[model samples]
Target: MQLSENLSPPEGETIDPTSRLLAASERLMAEAARRFPIAGDPHSRAYWMEAMINQAPDYFFFKDRDSRFLLANRAVISDLYKETDLTGRTDFDLFPPELAQQFFEIEQEIMRSGEPMLDMEEKIPDGRGGLKCLLTSKLPMRNEQGEIVGIIGVARDITERKRQEQLHLGQAELLKMIAVGAPLKDVFTALIHLIEGQIADVTGSVLLLDPEENCLRHVAAPNLDPNCFTRIDGIPIGPAVGSCGTAMWRGEPVFVADIETDPLWEGYRDLAVPYGFRSCWSAPIHSYQGQVLGSLGLYGRTPGLPSTTCQKLLGMATHIAGIAIERKQAEDRIQFVAHHDVLTGLPNRSMLDERISSAIEAADDANGTIAVAFIDLDNFKLVNDSLGHHAGDELLKTVSRRMLDKLRPEDSLVRLGGDEFVVLLTGPRRRGEQLSVRLESIRKAIADPVLLEGHSVQVTCSMGVALYPGHGRNATELLANADLAMYRSKEIGRDALQFFTAEMASSAHEKLRYQEELRRAIAREEFVLHYQPQMDLKTGHIFAVEALIRWNHPERGLLMPGDFISFAEDTGLIGQIGDWTLRAACRQNKAWRDAGLPPVVVSVNVSARQFQEPEWVERVASALRKSGLEARYLELELTESVIMADVQQAVALMHRLEALGVHLAIDDFGTGYSSLSALKRFPVDRLKIDRSFVQDLPDDPDDAAIARAIISLAHTLQLKVIAEGVETREQLEFLRGAGCDEIQGYYLSKPVRAEGIETLLRIPNI
Candidate 1:
C-alpha cells in the first residue's frame, strides 16, 4: 500500500510544472485513500503525508506545539526555503523576525484552543521584490487519543483579488470627485495617481488638446520629471508626434514600446529617454460627441507592450478623464456666456459694474481720477436703417476695434447695448488733457471711413465724461452723469465730447417737468398722428402711409417727437404713448376706408421699449380689433436696433403677429445691425430706408450706393423697399431708377392730418 516513490509524468511525454504537480497530487490522494484502513501504519502515513506535502500547489505546512515546521508543500519550499530543507525549521528560519513571530503566536493559540482559524488575510513577500496577499487557514492537528500534537496550515494567494477591490474603490472615489464638480486639475492629478498605482513602474500623465494651438499640453503628470514635462508641455500633435500627441492626433491608441527606436518618438525621444523613460502607451480621451478632448499616457521605465489588463485600465482611465474634462469645459463656456456679449464677445453689463468698481478701488488707493466716458455713436441708427442690419453690425465691430486701439491696456471698455458703450480710464489726478486726448483719438479713429456692405461709411461718436469723486460716486452715478454729458454733446453738435457739470444736472431736472407733462398729455388725449403718404413708384399713386406722432402741448404748442420723445422713453412713458399712437393710427385708417377713401396700409413706428414688451404682439392685435381696421390695413414698423437686439424672440413674435394678418416692416432698416442669415428668417413685408440715407441721395455716392443695395436686398427677399425723407424730385427719380418700390417724404407731402390724407386719397393719381 505504501509503494509510491514520487509522482511523475509518463515516459516520452512532456507537461508544464503546474500540470505535473496536479497529476502528482491526484495519485497521492488515491494512494492515501487505499492505505487509510491500515491503522497505526507509520510508514504508510509518513509516505502519504510527505508525497502530498511536496506535490500540492498551495502552501501547506505542519508544525509541532513549539511551532517548528514539520512539513511544507513544494510551493512553500520554492517560495520560502528554495534549495534548503524546511522540516524541523520554524517560520523564523524562513521569514523575517516579525513574520515568524506572528506565525508562532497564531499556531500557539490554535494549539491551546484546539480550534481553527479560517480565511485570515495577510501580506507576505512574493519573493519577487513585491508583496502578495494570502487567505490563510490554520487548524490544530490531533493524535489518535484526540490530544493536540501540532498545528496544520494552508494558504492561497489572493493578491489579484485584493488589487481589484482597491482599484474599484479608487475609481469610485475619483468619480465622486468629478460628480461634485471638483477642479479639473485636481481631478486629473488624482486620476493619474490612481492609474500609476494600478500599474507597475509607470508614471501616468494627461495631455489636453488645445484646438486653437493644435498642440497637446500637459495638464497632469503626477510622477514625470518637471524639466522634461515642461519641455513637452506644448508639443504639436501630428501623425508622427510622441505617444500622447500622436494618439490625440490619430484619435486612437498609440504604443511606443521603445522611445529610442520608435520613429513616432524621433524628436521627443530626448525629452523622455534621458529621464529614464523607455516606453510610452497612450489612449485618446474623447468627448461623447467623438471629439478628441485629450489623451491619457502611461510611461514606463522598461520597454515592453502593456499587458491586456494594463491596457484595459488605460481605456477606463481615459473615459473617466474625458467626462471630467468635458464637464469642466462646458461649465467654462457657460461662465463666459454669462459675462460676455454674444454679438461682439465683449464684456457686457453683467461685468461692467464689477470692473468699474474694481477700477475705483485701485484709483482710491493711488489717489487717482477715473474717467467714465459714455459713448454714443451719432447717427448710428441712420447707418443701420440705410445699410441693413448686416452692414450695421460690421460698422459697430469696426468702431469697437478702432476705439479699443486708442484705449490704454489698463482701461476697460464695455458695450452697454445698441450703439452705446462705456469706457473707463484711470490715471493720476489732473491727467485732464491726457484723458481728453485719448477720447479725441478714439473720436478721430471712429470718424475714419470704413467700407461696409460695399459702401465706404464714416461714423462719429458723442462722448460724455464724468470723473469719479467729482461727478458723484459709484458706477451708477458716474454712468448716469456721463450719459447726461453725452446727451449734452449731442445737443451742442454730434461728434463732440462734454464733461459732466452742474448745469447738465439742472437740465435733467427740467426734463423731469416735461416728463410729467407728457404723461398727462397722454391721459388728456393730447397726442395725434400725422399720415405721410407713401407713393407707389410704378403707379405714382399713394399706397401706404407712415403714421408720425405729434404731441399737442398746452403751452409749448405742437411739438415734434424729437423734442420730447427721448425724454418720454427715459421716463418709461413711451409704452403708453406708443399704444395710444397705434390705436389712433388704426382708427384713422379705418375711418378713411369707411369714408370711401382709397384703402392703404397705415404704418406705425414702434419704439424699442414697446417692441420689447412681453405682450407687444397682443397689443398690436388689440389695436386692429378695437379700431375695426382689417389687419391688412395696419403695419407695425420696428427699428432694426429693436428687432436685431433679440432675433430669436423677435422672429417668434413677428410670426405670431403675421398669423393675425398684420404686416411687419423693419423701420430705419439700414441704421441697425443684423446678419443676412438672420434677416432672411424675419417675417417682414417691407424695408423703410432711413431718411439719413435718402437726404443726400443721388449726390452722395455712399448714400446712393447704400440706398440701391437696400432696394436690391429687399426685392431679393420678396419684400418692398420705401425711401423716406425724399424732399426733391431728383431723389425720387434716383430711387425710382434704382428699383425702389415706394417713396415717403415732403416731395409727396409732409406728414398731414387724417383729413389731408383723405383729400389726397380722393385726388386722382395722388
Candidate 2:
C-alpha cells in the first residue's frame, strides 16, 4: 500500500503519492515554461500549457488522496491564503472551520460524482477581522488506474464582483422608479425603502435643504424615534454639527463611526444618546457640478462602521436625493411664471380681473361703495411723437411708479397698457362732493412732472370715477361707465375729472341711436336739395341758384343742418354728404339745361371736415362726368375755415379742381380766421359776403363798411363778389352801388323746392 492512501490526510486531499510527486515536478516545469514560454518553440505543447496556467487569475492546486496539498501554482500558493508556501499543506490549514468544511463537502461531492463543482461561493476569514467572498470550483482527478484519486480545485476572489452586482441591481431599480414619474416625496421614500431592503445593519433619514430658510428639514426617516426626529427637523448646517449637517457644510461625505467620541456630536450628544444611535455616516446630495443640495445619512445603534454594501447604498440614495430636489425646484419656477407678468413682475390682467371681481362682491355684501377710477393721460401722443418710443416706455414706467405711490395700502393700482391706469378705492364714499374732491386729488397726483433722462416731462391724466351699485351693479358695467365718463372729461378740455351720471349714459345711448339712423338714412336716400335764387344786383334779375341740403324725416317732416350735422362731422360722415351734394347740384344744373331753362350756375358749399379727404378732387371730377354738366357752370362754395384748415392741401385741391374747369368761390369770406396775405394764395372765381354782415348792412355803419371793404377787395383781386341774405331793397341798392357781382336772400327768393324754382325764374323783373 502507498503511504498517501493509508495516511488519510484530512478532507480535500485526494491525490496518491506518486501522482503528487509527478504534480510537483510538473509545477516546477510549469514555472520554468511560464518564464520562457515563447523561447525555442513558440507552438510547443509545454509552452501552451504554461501560457494557459499563468494567464489564469484563479488559484489552481493539486492534492493527494490523504488530503495534503502536493503542488500549488503561484496564484494558489501566494493569493488564496496570503502565504508564499503551500507545499504539503492540507485545505484545513488554509481556511477556518466553516470555510474548510464547505470546501471539503464540495470536493467530496465532485470526487464521488466525477463531475466538476462550478463556481461555489464561500466567505473566508480575511485575518483582519473581516470576511472576503471567494468562488471555488473543484474537479475530480483520475489516476492512470482509471480511479478517482484526488481533486484539483480552482478558487477566485469575487468580493468586488458581488458588490458590482448589487450596485447594478440598485441602479436598475432606481431607473425603473424614475421612469414611472413618481412624485419627489414618493421617490425619496422609495429610495429609503430600497436601502433598508438591500443593505443590512443600517437605517437612515433623508433631509432636504431649504435654502430660503437656511435650514435642513427631515423629509423622510426610518427606524428613528419620533420625538428625536421632530427635534432635528430644522437643524442648521455648520461645522461640528450632526453628520448630515457637517456633510452638507463640508460638501463631502462624513463618517462618524462612534458618535459618542466624534467632535461633530459634541454639541448634540443628547440628540445622539437618546436615539440609541452610536454611529452615523452621511453623504452629501449634490448636483453633478458639486453643489450640495441636501444630505442622506445612516444611523447605527451599535458602535460599528458601515460595511461596503451599506456605503454603496448611501451613494445611490444621494443620487436620488439630487434628482428629487431638482424636480421640485422646476415645479416652483413654473408656478411663479404662471401668475406673474414677465415684463413688470406684477400680477397680470387675469389676476387683476379676479381681484376686482372679488372686491366688488365684498363691497356688495358689506353694503359699501367701491370707487373705480379710470385714468388716461392727455397729450400722451405729443410726447410719444416728439421723444420717440423708448422715452415713451420710460415715461410709462415712471407714471406707473407715481400712481402706485399715490394709492393706499388697500387700494390696487393696475396698468391697462400704455398711459392708462385704474385705481380701485374700497370703502363707502362720504358724499358725492367728497368723491369728487378725492378724484380731483388723484388727478393732481398723476399730473406731476417727471424727470426723464435729464429732461423735465409734464403729464396730466383725465379721471372718470364710478361708484359701486350707484353707477353700475356689475364689474363690466362699472368699467364701462367709468370709461364713458373719462371720455366726457376729455371732451370738456382734458386734465379734468368727472363722475358717472344718468345724463352721460343717456348721451351715450343717443349717440348710438344717431349712428344707426345715419347709416339707415344714407342707405334709404332720405336726403334732398333745395335751391335759393341769386339775382344780379344792378338789374334785379335772377341769374344763378345756390344749392342747400335738406333732410326729410319719415316722421319729423323736415330737418335742417343743425339737426344732425355735428354728429355727421364727428363720425366722418360729412365726406359722403359732401359728395352727394356735389353730384345733386351738378345734376340739377344739367337738368335745367336739358329742360330748356336758364343756364344758372348751381353752387354748393363744401365743409372743412370734408376738404381733408385725399379723394375729394377725384370724387368731384367723377360726379361732373356722370351728370353731363359743364364743369365751368359748376361752382364749389368754400368757407374761410375750410381754406384755412390745411392751407397746403387746400391749395393743391383748388389747383386740381381749377384744372378740371370747375369754379371755386370762397363762401362766408370775412367771418373766419383768414389774413389778406393768406386770401391772395387761394385760386378762386368769386367771394361771397356772409349773411351775418349783410343782415345789418345799409343800417349799421360797421357792417356796411365791412361789406364795402370786402367788395372792393374782391374787385381789386379780380374776383366776383356776392352779397348773401340781402332782405331789403336798400341793402340791395347799397350792394348794387358797391358793384357786388350777385345778391341772394328772401328779398330775391327764399330757398324753394325744385318745382318752385321755375315759377321764381318766370316772375317779372323786380
Enumerate residue pairs that collide in model 2.
Answer: 9-66, 13-67, 14-64, 14-65, 14-150, 15-64, 15-65
Q: In angstroms, how far off is 78's CA in candidate 2?
A: 27
Estimated TM-score for each candidate: 0.58, 0.40
lDDT by residue (1-766, candidate 1, tens digit) is 3323454557898788777666666666666667663434434546667665667767888888898888778888787446357778877866799997998888899999888999999888776767788999999999999999998889988888988998899899887776555788889999888888778899988889999999978788867888977998877899999999899989999998999899999878898888899999999999988999999999899999999999999989999998888666644443454456545777777678788899899989988779899999989999999999779988888888888888778888898778999988876534346677877887889899999888999888899999988996898789989999999999998999999999888866777787788878989989878889999989988888989999888898999999988878878999999999999999888998888888899998889899889898888888889999999988989887788789888898889989999889988765555543356788899888888778877987766766766675566567989888999999999998999999998998999998888889988795
lDDT of each: 0.84, 0.77
- Tell me the alpha-carbon RMSD of every candidate: 17.9, 31.3
TM for candidate 1 is 0.58
Instruction: Name the top lDDT candidate.
Output: 1
